[model samples]
Target: MPEPHLLAADTDRAAVVTRLDESLADGRLTLAEYEDRSARAHAARTYGELADLTADLPLPARREPARREPARSPVASALHGGAWHGAWGHDLRAAWTGWVTTAVIVVGIWLVTVLGSGDLQYPWPVWVIGPWGVVLLARTIGERRSQDTDRQQLPA
Candidate 1:
């Protein structure tokens, strides 16, 4: 690397200003000193002049890149229709089978209750089935939208 005194003033001035900004915040530089140093930094023509402004302050730490979720695969979608058909480790087919089996059990109880009483009663199964159906509908819509979004953005 070239000596600090040999570097161009304007090229490294931002780095010095940033350090000066920190010094001001840390009470190392008063408002007057900060103002004077900031002006000198911008007007500096040599790297030596710029370096003089914040020689006492440490350099800012380097930042790490952000982490993101793994990208969804098209092959996974084509094979599965949707990746999550079941909660936990179960597939969609199993989820549907479980739901259907539950519905049958609920209806069977309602039927036996009505028959035993020998009186007409409201179809109370609607309360259970109605909400279950709505949840399925929402899941289906969300999956469709996700698939569409995947289609729109081609992987680089």
Candidate 2:
């Protein structure tokens, strides 16, 4: 490793800014502190100056490269949809839950209105539910297509 007192490169400054941003997002630092540190990082001229801003923070975690597996069991593949799908599944599940919750609430309100009027009204809740469901479906399809494209481009 180089000496901390040495002049810093643009990359070094950028790294410090990224750390400050992460700290702010994780509630480790207040917005004011993050702004101050970020500005200092951009103006930093030496490695020591940049290091000082993040001295109290823990080191960032290092990510290991993804290891491609040759095959998955039929059940595992069906449940998880291979590697990329498994990674995106959690996010999709959350979005699906949100949609379901909203749909139930909207339908409940519509039912209450119909009972109060003593007549079946036009299903206005469908206007809210239909477009949202379509958008979610489109997003899922788009992501699946993107993952397929990525898998095809991978080295065999």
Which candidate leads the pack in TM-score?
Answer: 2
What tens-digit string does per-residue lDDT give for candidate 2 at 1-156? Answer: 268879999998998898887776566887568778989999988888898999999887886987766567767765874534544443665576567768989999999999999999999999999998998897788677877888999999
- Candidate 1 has its poorest 10 consecutive residues by lDDT at 85-94
Q: Clashing residue pairs in candidate 2, if any?
A: none
Error of 2 at 139 (Å): 0.6
Across residues 19-114, which tens digit of lDDT does each residue of candidate 1 receive?
886666656776668779989988887777887777776766676975654556767755776565323222333344445657888999999999
**Global lDDT scores for all candidate models:** 0.70, 0.80
Q: TM-score of each candidate?
A: 0.38, 0.42
Q: Indicate which candidate wins on lDDT.
A: 2
Question: What lDDT is obtained when candidate 1 is compared to the true structure?
Answer: 0.70
List where candidate 2 sits over 4 angstroms from the true fold.
1-90
